[model samples]
Target: MNCEFVIKEEGHLTQSENGPEVMYKEIKTEGDDDIKSETFPAGDPLAFEDTKLEMDQREEQEDGIYIPIQCSQTGENDFTCESLNDVSNKSFTRKPSDYTHSNEKPYKCSVCNKSFTQKGSLKMHLYLHSNERPFRCPFCIKSFIQKSHLNEHLRLHNNERPFKCSFCNKSYTTKSYFNIHFRLHSNEKPYKCFVCSKSFTQKSHLNEHLRLHNNERPFRCSVCSKSFTQKSHLNEHLRLHSNEKPFKCSACNKSFTTKSYLNIHFRLHSKDKPYKCSISSKSFTKKSHLNLHLRSHNNEKPFKCSVCN
Candidate 1:
């Protein structure tokens, strides 16, 4: 029977005086789910081919190769793929055969009800559902689901900003952030709100804008019944219930619940009145104070005078 052998160790093959040493460990038979892995050293003659092979033939796996296994399983073979025919380039193609394009997605995720053709794809999808972040940033308390995401996050700690925009000449640590900023210059708003028909550069911004029309506040405070459009806003609201102020001012030693509040408080110490009223041309330290001052010019009294009424 034709047995499908799993490619181990970057799917790399090493050439020796004996033969092309393809170190394969676990080989699954065609008929069953149970994998029967048997080790056999390089010897006299054991030819392996995929198509046009006899019942007692063995060959490389079709679709399941290069699915990403632990490095320990790779053995002592130099990396390679692109079918058994061409192995001279040392480049690997994870999906090269027509068999991989099957519409049948047997594996399904329980959390989000998402389905995938491969079991490995479903396993990777399941990572987003749980808080199982294997990769951690050394600079911050943040963690990532993949090591590649953590590698991109590490650029924030370093001085170098690799991804630069050609249009605006602005630099970003990550490519994803750089791409979103570049869209602003090009006016390429791919994410459009269906309700308002408003265009946004980013999908996250569009989702936030949709909240105004739909009133879809997914993040709700457990203590209070109040809901917020974003999770970060909900987190800030939680501090009010707990009476916790994490951000403290260095000059006056006054504490605030959020960093944005702490930054506004800094303006009071520096005497930097940035918020200027348009009507009166009067400057205020805080934007909220400037907004309150604007109400007097417009004769907008939200608070009622109980004694006069």
Candidate 2:
């Protein structure tokens, strides 16, 4: 949210930013009323440690409430939306950080007793307790708690990928997914691991990498009892027991358990040899095959028979 527009009801205004955190301003309207306007960095899908800010733990200066409102559409991509004052007849008295500051959680969940700063935010959080999915997809039997989620689900059914990468031959249904993918081309690693000081483009990738350092394998196979750091890896491991090859090739009737294998299978049909031997000018479909071919050039017999060795 880029809040640069002037408010109709004016007073004095103050603003500041902490690191790569949100850029926000405090508008002190008449009668000492506080109206907050916040703008986070555009195309940044992270909401972890970098965004964490401990609010000033001071006395309540004003006796007013706050309601978050934007000039237009609000979603995962907040940087795109321009924040205007009094849009949808809404007023702000406190920033989101103030909830942690004053310990003032006005909205409380009836089911779980969980507290929240905003009413709308609390209403969305209640969906978890009630198991209520209001947003339903007409094409499929899937339902979602938020409308934005349902919109993204609908795109899958429609085969619509609106966000196309200018740098690569890739597209994404959601802006957040696109932003994460775009980071790979830009070589921007925002999420850093505190333990190893290693970084990753997305926060989820950093979380997965942290599991390696912690020796945490949460996703366990029911059949084999083998554990994996990621659910996708567990799903792929399960295919060995089930022999379920879901990903199918369009050109041929060949199927694979994983999408990566299916993508490699497509190269066979297209004759797309991305992996090449620099010495011989020979190409191969897989990097493993090219590595094996490279071994022949150096006469490196790494794989020795047990009896012979």
Candidate 3:
């Protein structure tokens, strides 16, 4: 004899008897497909229950299930399996606990020997060693390694001077440059030269002053092979090579390489005698003329008669 009992939505359980032994058949299905079938001896009920429990546990394990948990170090909520995988995939060979606690940097730059805790940071540092700039500006030929630096450089081409000073109506291309310019109005000289005890509003100025003490002229003229302490001086010298007079006098239509020369020319148009002799109360338009007049009062013969002397 055989008896069948339908289980909820799934296949049915069948009972069969042969002689003095009882047998049970369990069939599982999905929609119209037959999944599997198993037979359990009716005499051993405890063994059937144990087998079913183990099968349920195996199915749960096969589902690739994970629970969300808070990270012990970061205190952030993350998936248990994913966070473990992230820690395991780190470039360093140290244990996760050691990576979190230790200050030891296993990743070192081959060029500069600079050490970094993370491999990604070391990879970024390697860009500085190489001259390769993959990120190029669309407006200019300039290029940069990082996208953020390229974005900053683009502001110069766009003429985007967003930072403004409160004391003056002057604007700057960047907040850092604006802060440095503000120091001039505030009379703040934070950067001091250790050699001469001279102070400057900017660190770049102090660095340039240090070069003067060292007698280092890094900027050299390509045409004349003349060297200058400042790059601005080198740029002005280049104007002589190009014959490019940028500054022009409005009154005389005379051109000059520098604005200082144009300002001296302006005194001729305006008759502005700024330089005065303290002894004679006589004024001259040019400081050089006043200096020559002062030599007369002092009876100083700078141009000596070589044969008589």
How would you encode candidate 2's per-residue C-alpha lDDT over 1-309 as one tens digit per residue?
A: 343322222232212121212223233344545444334343222221111121121111222222233433232212212233222222334343432334566778998898865555666788888899888889879998777688788899888999999988699999989999998888999999999899999889999999999999999999989999999999999998999999999998899999999999999899999898999999999999999999999999998889969
Candidate 1 accuracy as lDDT:
0.61
Residue-level lDDT tens digits of model 3 in 58-132: 221121111222233444432112223432222112222221334767778999899965554565578788987
* Collision pairs in model 3: none
C-alpha lDDT score of every prediction, in listed order:
0.61, 0.64, 0.62
Estimate the Cα RMSD of every predicted model relative to the unseen true structure.
11.9, 13.0, 21.4
Using TM-score as the yardstick, the better of models 1 and 2 is 2
TM-score of each: 0.50, 0.57, 0.50
lDDT of 1 by residue, 1-309 (tens): 222333433323222222332333223456445444333444211222222121112112332343323233333234333234434324232322222333666667998778865444565567788868767788899988666677777887786698889876889988889989988778899998887789999999898988888878999888878998999999999999999999999998999999999999899899889889887789999888998998999899899989995
Candidate 2 TM-score versus the reference: 0.57
Colliding residue pairs in candidate 2: none
Best TM-score among the predictions, by candidate number:
2
CA lDDT of 41 in candidate 3? 42
